[model samples]
Target: MTYDIAIVGAGIAGASLAAAIGARARVLLIEGEDAPGYHATGRSAAFWSETYGGPDIQPLTTASRAALQAGGFLQPLGSLHIGRPRDAAAIDAFLAEFADTPVRLERVDPAAIVPGLRPEWTLGVSEPSCAYIDVATLHAAHLATARRAGAVLATRAPFHAATRAADRWTIETGAGIFQARVLVDAGGAWGDVVARAAGVDPIGIRAYRRTVVQLRTDPPAPAGLPHVAHIAGRFYFKPEPGGRLWLSPHDEAPTDPCDAAPEEIDVATAIDRFEHVVDWRAAAVERRWAGLRSFAPDRRPVYGFDARVPGFFWCAGQGGFGIQTAPAAASLAASLLLGEDVAVPVDPARYAPGRFGR
Candidate 1:
């Protein structure tokens, strides 16, 4: 049978897109893993902050607010950035860069911050617009919605090859073959690989490894503790459930696309940075894992129809903002494929794939 759209990689990007398109098109969602969201989507820190990405990405973040709230995917958890005296210039630059964004951020005195902090942190900037996202629930909700809307979702169906036939493309996978008028590539770190396999020119998407560690705290879970990050963002710590804390050194080393693993050095660096910032001792590491955040050369998402390949579309390179911006991004992708009006508030120029060719 033939489908209107065939989406590769059932991560947050693909699943969300599938859900957004709904019954407007016959959509086929394929994933190589035993289940959906088994890669970077499943390993995300899952925070929704309007101040996170670049200026161009602000519209997407703002546009996603309503969907996320209506879906009950967000919780009230504010975020704060702490910096030392020597880092004043960097913090000032950050505040100035994001001043026009919707995030409610304000700088506070270092002495005022030291009282609430663990005594090690000094200067601080707080944003009330930040919140925690229930990532698993969000992913599951989208998948369920897509299925209910008559979308075909196939797990463990790895795409092996693709060939254009007339106006449609035949895609062969381990499970079966399917034909579609349009193809969406949301393969995360392996996005370029899938594009090349389908005879599409790669847009130079690079995957960078990011390592994170979960540690068991000594006493309270720090549930209400503000998500903390230094001025340079070399490390960050946030409260987790069950008396645990998620820590990361903000490591971004270049890596090949695969199941990423944490390096010992990265873990050690995170621990050292944590020690310097807080008095808490990381007695034992409960768990450690790594995931790749794919980026375009310009460090923004790529979303548009392939200029050379008529029916091929690009929807990868979300970096770490995939979960937070999924709703708007998916809406944009669906609009582009269905030739419908852009529903979200974001401008097409910021995320268009053609920008890379210029």
Candidate 2:
């Protein structure tokens, strides 16, 4: 069947774009897994801090607040950054950079760090506006909205080949053959692979492995505790729903695109980092997993059409901000495909794929 647009990968990026464009065009949303969000989108830390991304991405975060609030997917979980006296300079720089954003960060004394924070952390900052996102709920909501708007969603439908003729493109996939006038590559870590298969030049996209572990803690966490990150983001810990603590070393080791598994060494490093920074001991590790965060050579998300391929579009290289920046990113993609002007507050030039050529 022919579609107006065929979106590869049904994660946050693809799903959001599908939902946005479904009303305007026939969208075919395909996923490799049995279900959507089985990869990085399912394993995110679920934060909505505006200070998380670089200058190029901050405007998107700012513009997405209304949608997030209207959808009821955000909760004020708050975030705190703690560091030793030696790291004060780094902390100062962070404060100065985010001073004008919606995120309200305040410097606090060591004692004011979370109630049980280790005394070793003498300098701290708290961002009251930072919040936790309900990722699964948000993803489900978008998928439902897209399906209701007449978009076809197919799982376990990995694209195998693509060929373009005139203004149309034909794609062969595990599910079946499909045709579309436009193609969106939102395949997360497999973005480069998909582009190459579609006869487009790979855009130097790289994936990095990030590991997270859930641990059962003794005495549980004190009430009102906020998500805490060590200086340089070497490690981070947040309260989980079941009185558990989710921790990560914030490691970004370059990795090939594949199903990632947590390395023992990475888990051990996370444990050590947590132990050094927190007063409470992590009693037992209950579960562990890893996900791949893809980025371009410039560390910014690449969006818009492929310079060499007329009907092919790019919406990859989101890195860790895929979930946080979904609203604006999807809107931008839809705008580009529909030949409409960019409506989101983000500058199109910063995220355009053509930036790599310069």
Candidate 3:
């Protein structure tokens, strides 16, 4: 059956976009794996911070807050950007960077916010609006919403090739062949691959591996502990129930798109960095995983139609801010996809795929 639009990935990007446009068009949510969100969406560390992904991305994150809160997907969990005396300039730059924005940031004592913070790590910036996102629930809700809106979901459908003829696309995938008037490349790390196979010029979307590890610390993590991150982008950690801690080195190692695995070095680096921040010791690593974060050359998400390919849309290059910004990003993409008025506050031109030349 021919669909009005066929989204090539059923992760958050595709699922959310499908939900946004499904009511207005015939939509198909294609998943490469047996289950949707088997990649980055499933491995997200699940936090929404307005300052994440830099100022260029803050607009989308801020715009999405209301929706996320209304859907009950957000729970109060503030964040603390901590730093050492030597990082004063970085701290000031961080503050100065978002000074013009509506995000609330205030100076605080690092030790007061994060218990056991080392004496050398003295400065802190508190972001009260930061919160934990119920990622699983959010993803499921989008999929359910799409289904209710008459969107079809095809699992195990890894897109292979596509050919455009008479302004329609014939798409080849693992599951089968399908036809759509518009084909969307929301394949996350494989977004460029999808574009290439669809006979469109790739937009230099590169994937990087990020690692996270759960640790049982020597001292049980405090329930009230805020999400702690280094100003220098060295590490970040947040408390989990049962006295566990979720930590990452903030490493963004460039790698090819694949099933990402936590490297031993990265896991070790996370623990090593954690020790310097606080007095607590890592008793054992309970779990470890990694996921890919794809980014355009400019590190901003790419949306809208491809400049060189008619009826081809891009909904990729979201990096780590995809989940937090999903609501606005999806709305913007939907508006572009359906020829509707843009509802999101952010300017769509900033994320337009045409920003990259063919």
Candidate 4:
């Protein structure tokens, strides 16, 4: 059967987009893995921080907050952007950057909130709007919503090739061949690859590996410990329910698309960085994993059709902010795809695929 739109990737980007499109169009959600979200979406250390993807991404994140909260996917956890004494300039810059934005930012004593904080790490910027996202639930809900709206999900359907003829696209995948009026490259890390296979120009989407380690600390992390991140982007850590701590070195090493794994050096670096921030001792390394975060050349999400490729849409390059901004991003992409009015207040032209030029 010919679908109105075929989305190549059943991760957050594809699933959320499909959910947003709803019954407005006949949709096909394609997944290369045996199940959807087996890649980046599944591996994300999910958190909703308005300042995560920088100022450009904040609008989408802010716009998505209501929808996410309404769906009961957000749990208030707050966030603290901590800095060392020498990072006073960075602290000031952070505040000045978001002064005009709705995101509430305030200065605070790091040690007061984050116990055992090193003396030198005196500066702190509190973002009270930060929260933990129920990623698995959110992803599952999107897929369910889309399915309920009559979208078909084809698992293990690795897109191999596609040829545009007339007004339809003949898409070949591992599952089988299908036809769709519009083909969306929501393949996450493999987005560019899908675009290339479809004879469309790639948007230079590059994937980077981010490492996270779950550690059992000597003093048992406090449940109230907010998500703590270094101003220098050296590391970030937050408390887990069982007195464990989730930490990341904030490393963005460029790597080819694949099942990413944490490097020993990266793990060690995270522990070393964590130690420097607080007096807490990491007693055991419980777990370590890595995920790929793809980004466009300008580090902004691409959410519109390719200007040069007919019936081809670009819905990738969301980086690490995809989960937090999914609702708004999906709304924007759906508007563009279905020729509807922009659902969110953010300017669609900013994230348009045309920004990269033909």
User: All models: lDDT?
Assistant: 0.86, 0.87, 0.94, 0.94
**Model 3 off-target regions past 4 Å?**
none
Give lDDT: candidate 4, residue 186.
97
Candidate RMSDs in order: 1.6, 1.3, 0.7, 0.7
Q: Ten residues in a row with the worst lDDT in model 4? A: 114-123
The residue-by-residue lDDT of candidate 2 on 1-358, one tens digit each, is: 7999999999999999998886899999979899999999999988887777656677777788789989998988888888998998999899888777666778877467466667778888887777889999999998999999999988888889899997898998999898999999999999999999999999999999999999887657666678888767799888888788889999899999988999999999998898887667889999999999999988889889988889999999999998888988899989988999889877788889888773
TM-score of each: 0.96, 0.97, 0.99, 0.99
How well does candidate 1 score on lDDT at residue 121? 56
> lDDT by residue for model 4 over 1-358, one digit each (tens)?
8999999999999999999999999999999999999889998888899999889999999999999999999999999999977899998988888889999999998889988888888899999999999999999999999999999999989899999999999999999999999999999999999999999989899999999999999899987989999987899988788999999999999999998999999999999999988898999999999999999999999999889989999999999999999999999999999999997999999999998886
Instruction: Extract clashing residue pairs from model 4.
Output: none
Model 1 clash number: 0
Q: Model 1 scores what on Cα lDDT?
A: 0.86
Q: How many residue pairs clash in each candidate?
A: 0, 0, 0, 0
Error of 2 at 100 (Å): 3.8
